[model samples]
Target chain A: MRQHLKKAGIILFWLLVWQLVSLLVHNSVMLVGPVETIKCLCRLVVTADFWLSIWYTFWRIGLGFLCASLLGILLAFAGAKKLILGEFLSPFFAALKSVPVASFVVLLLIWFGSKNLSFFTSLIVVLPILYGSTREGLANNDKKLLEMAQVFRIPFGAKLHYILLPGLSPFWKSAFSLALGMCWKAGVAAEVIGQPLQSIGNRLYQAKIYLETGDLLAWTVVIILLSFGVEKAFARLLRLLPGEEKKEPDSMKEKGDVA
Target chain B: MTIQVDHVSKFFDGQPVLDNFCMELSDGNSYLLTGPSGSGKTTLLRILLGLTRPDSGRVRLLGDYKYSAVHAGVVFQEDRLCEPFSAVENVAMVSKKLSPRIAREALEKLLPADALDKPVRELSGGMRRRVAIVRALCVPSDVLLFDEPFTGLDRENRKKAIDLILAEKGSVPLLITGHSDEDLGFCHPIDIRTGVPLQMG
Candidate 1:
């Protein structure tokens, strides 16, 4: 309850600032007021194109994020178990992490057309984070627990499920939370630069091109909601996996066996 | 039917823990290894459990390679129970799946039935110690190693935990290290002193 109240207070405080800024700006094109932006949002909601663009941008980026996360986890497991493989991937992952996003996007545009540029860009951008964080999570886990598991003759799968997953969940959460936002932003950026028709990023680019400030503000709101909504959904699923395990602790043994 | 430790010795930074240590146990029996704090009790246990290597000599089981402890179960001094798992799951972790009734029955002797549902992280320190005891005992193993199993438990809880071990794991060739006579009640402890074999002085 305290958290909810804190969040409500922050929202109200920000809305008051938006109201003040809107009144000061006066010119509608220069900055669309929050009230007008909401009105513009409601108007756009009635259109089929807006929904299509939202879904399009959402799924494409969602796919890229999923691909990177799954492969990252798999690679982390491999690298953890095999020192040689882990050493081999060190420089590659390091370079991937240090390389700027703009450079990847520009290079990807040349390799792939604007339509699929965002998809590839999202994959390249999120992979290093997922890899690095999951690797660190695996490496940072308590060695004592692993020794105990070994002495107990725990099966390989059980070790991964019980020992490995719980250890990695925190890192995975942070990695996914951060990577989800980046994928959406970079995916949209790719679309904007590439100007793929019938996409949210394309719509955003068009808004900027014509100086349709109301449309621009409305689209920005859509992007924020999409990104925020998706992240919340992922976090909810994460909370639920452990939540469902809570009601019956013993059942977790079976789940742990499968984990 | 027996484990053989032929002239096994280990040193860390030139300090010997197991200096030409030799011992053997056949079939089902238990031995309490009494030694000073750093007198290789844990190092010996680790070698027997295949988690460490000796500087000289080797451990063999029934004339087999030393990796045999891949089948051994161990209860460490720090109660290496998974903090997020309940008492029952921690024991059931190594057992066959589909909710073994033995797992529930194992914790019944040492922990409250309600604790079977609470994660070990929520349990008190003494409670976690009991859970670790249950885990090592419930799972099948030819051998078990306990490194000072009853260090921090209160007298009453320690006695109860000891009783649970005797009842659950009868004659399991257990190797334990502790100064307390409480553990000696369960088995005859073989004293290993550092500078030389324990003298009667």
Candidate 2:
């Protein structure tokens, strides 16, 4: 409770600073305070279009993220099995990591158009991260444990449940946290460029065109909330997976051994 | 099943770990491998499990085996229990034939009931070693290879563990590597350095 109150107090302090800056500027067009942004958000939430825009962006990006995660895991397994495939795809993933999101957005717009821009953009943005993390996780699995499994002639299903999943958990947790945020930022950017209909990005574009600072800030706030909500929800879902429990710390183990 | 290690030699960095080693492990017998540290005890176990390749010579399985490969239940030098999993999970994970109930019962012989559900990492070294021993015994196999299984175990716990292993081994060839032959008088002692069976007085 104290930690939560401390967080809220910190947020209030920032909000006060923002309000003072806006008042000194004295131009609502250039800057809007937290109050005005909240008021705009309240007005916008009553409209069906607002909800529609959210649904449109949410499902497309969510589906894209889902597809990327699945494909990335499959490809990582394949790559781990085939050394040549891993060697072959190394440069491609490297290029994907380094290429500008804007370049991909523009290219995707030309090829696929605005209808599914967010979907494709988010998929491309998230795939390499999941793939790399999964591959690293596979590489980091304990060789001794694997040898034990092999000697025991344990079935593949049991090996996956007992060994592979637990080894992959930490890597996937960090990768999901990172990829979730990147997919949203890239997905929304793609929508803004493509000017997709019934999208938060489209509204953001419109807000920019008319210089509606309040709407722009309100939409930004919405994006932040949506990103945070999806991350938390995804984390909760990951915790539900079997074999995802926290391991006892090494210090505790050492102390036990000493005793 | 009989394992034939005929003139097997392994070299690492131009040093002979197992120089012209030979041993024939037959069914319904137990062998205790005794050697000083860095005397290729672990390398021999790894060779038997097919985890490492002998630079010269071959290992063969002579038996009326249905499969071409030898299925072994091995306890590595290190406690290779999945650190995040409980002792019961570790034991039961090796084979579907061994249910959680069976695992719990077997573990109760060597470990306390309360430590059965806690993650093996939270357990002491002695407890974790017991979990590894139980895991090896729970699996169905043609042979059992345990390397330094008595590490981190007390005299009482070691006696209990040996009793459990003997009771559960089920006529398979049991090869254990350790430093001393005092606790393992029942097992035929093999000097790993010389690759010869020592006479039991």
Candidate 3:
């Protein structure tokens, strides 16, 4: 409870600072305080268009992330098994990581239309991260455990359940955390450029053109909340995967044990 | 089946770990392989399991073997139980022939009932060792290989583990490595360095 209060107090301090800065500027066009941004958000929430815009971008980007994750894991498994495939794809994934998100967004807009820009953009952005993390995870799997499995002739399904998933959990968790945030940023940027109809990015673009600082800040706040919410939800989903849960040692409870 | 270690030699970094070691491990017998540290006890076990290949020698499974490959239940020097899994899951995961119920029964013979449900990581060292022993016994294999399986085990638990292994490893060749032959005198004692049976004085 104290920790939560401390966090709220910190946020309130920053809001006070933001309000003072906006009052000094005295131009609502250039700067809007937290109060104005919240008021704008309240007004936007009542409109049907606001919910529709959220749904449009949410499904597209969410689908892109899910598909990329599946593909990345499958490809990483194949890559790990075949050295030649890993060697072959190393440069391709590296290039994908290096290329700027804007360049891909522009090129995607030309090849495809604005309709599926966020989907493709987010997919491309998240694929390499997932692939790299999974590859590293596979590489770091305990060799001794694998050898034990091999000697015992444990089936592939059992090995995957007992060894592979648990080994990959840590890497996947960190990678998902990173890729979730990256996908949202890239997906929204693509939407803004493509000006997709009935999308959050389209609203953000309109807000910019009309110089509605309050609407812009409000939409930005919405994106932040959405990104945070999705990340938390995805993390909770990841916990369902089979692995070890870390717990504090209860010395008193551990006594009188026999083996 | 008899596992013949025919002059098996393994070297690391141009140094001889096992120089022309030879031994015959026949079926329905247990061996206590005694040696000091760095005496290639583990190397010999690895060679039998085909995890490591000898530099110049070969291992042969003589007699009628149902399978082309050697299937072994091994307890490694380290307690290689999946740390996140409970003792029952660890044992059950080794073979489809063994289920969670079967594993729980086997583990109950050596471990406390309360410890069976907890993750192996949370268990004490001796408890983890016992879990490894149970996992090895639960797996279906033609041979049983244990390297330092008694580490961290007290005399009472050690006796329980030994009894469980002997009961479970029926008609299979069992090779266990340890620091001494005390309390393991029932098995034929062999010094790994000499690769021959020790003189029982």
Candidate 4:
């Protein structure tokens, strides 16, 4: 809510200036009013095609992000435990992080069909962020606490659930939040270039084809809102995970056997 | 079980922190580890904890190697509690089955009772020191190793912390390292000088 309130204040301040600029310019073609954009959004929302377009893009982009996060977390754990594996993956992660999104989109389009284009693009963008943050968090974990756990013969599952998870949560959550936003932006950009059917990117391509700047702007708003909603939802989900609660004595028990 | 150190030598950057040091604990009992600064008191504790290996010789327990049994519970000079977590959570991180009331009781002896709910970062230096000692005691270990466990506490807090350490179960042995004469009053510490002693804690 704090973030939303801050966002609302910023957008309102910018919108007031945008409205004044549109009125002074006296041309919707040059600079559209916020109200006009809202009107365009409302009109698009009434259509089933627009809703389908939104869902199609959302699924593809969301899947890519999910895949990236899972693999990134697994790889991070592996890389943290083994120096050789970490060394092997270093240049590979660096390459993915430094490469341009457009370049990857073009290369991936040639490799995969346009239908799954956004999925691949999202993975490429999200992977390095999750991997880097998780590795750093694991490396900087409370070494003394780990030693204490070892001396006490703490159950392996308990060590992961209690010590490792709490330590890694902040890094994972922040990386996931940023990566979610990046994946959505890059995924949409890829879709716009590829023009997948029943997708927001395809709608954007259509708008540009017909010179409908308002349609382009409206679809852009839908993409942003959907991405923001997902990020907020995921953050809530992260909080709900069992490992997140700091006060473990209240809830933690011998949950089966330690691996 | 006895912890025996036999002719162990340790060097950091070739400075010879400890040379041919040795000590033997008779059995499960209390011991005060005392030495001058740079006498390798902390390094000896680290060797006992298996955190640092001796450059030569070995530390063994009951004729077995160190870490072979549930060896030692260590309290370092620094209060290394997790900053974002409550003092109780920091303790619980090491001892999963550690009861809340038990942890509270352990902390209550050395700290203000109200500090149980506060994060370690919000705690005062003395309070964190107490928490660290409580954490080490909370873990069920065969031998307790404390490194400068009474650094910042005033006389009142120090007595309380020492009392808490005494309150722990007797089956586990306690070895403490400190520079204060008052700290040595609780147990007759074998005086260790620079270079190597023929005995160990």
The 10-residue segment of model 1 chain B with minimum total lDDT is: B192-201
- lDDT-better candidate, 1 vs 3: 3
Q: Best candidate, DockQ-wise? A: 2
What TM-score would chain B of candidate 3 score versus the native chain B? 0.94
In model 3 chain B, the worst 10-residue window by lDDT is B192-201
DockQ in order: 0.47, 0.76, 0.75, 0.33
lDDT per residue (tens digit) for residues A147-213 in model 1: 8887776887778767877887788788889998999888998888887778998999888888888
Against the true structure, what is model 4's DockQ?
0.33
Kindly state the number of residue pairs that clash in model 4.
Answer: 4
Higher-TM-score candidate of 2 and 4:
2
Residue-by-residue lDDT tens digits, candidate 1, B1-201: 467677788989988778887777555777777877888888888888777999998876874535546366577878887777767777888866526577888788877888887878889887888878778876677777778778678988888887777676655577778887763664666776532232222
Give per-residue lDDT, candidate 2, residue B153: 94
Once superposed on the true structure, which residue ranges of model 1 sit more than 4 Å away at CA? A1-6, A241-259, B63-67, B97-100, B183-186, B194-201
Candidate 1, overall lDDT?
0.79
Candidate 4, residues B1-201, lDDT tens digits: the string is 777788788989998887787777655577777778888988888787777889998987874535564456678877766676788777776765787777777777777778888768888888888888888888767788888888888998888788768777466667888877684575647555533244424
Q: Which stretches of candidate 2 lie over 4 Å from their true place?
A: A246-259, B66-68, B197-201
State the C-alpha lDDT per candidate. 0.79, 0.90, 0.90, 0.80
The residue-level lDDT of candidate 3 at A40 comes to 100
Order by DockQ, highest first: 2, 3, 1, 4
Classify candidate 4 by CAPRI docking class.
Answer: acceptable
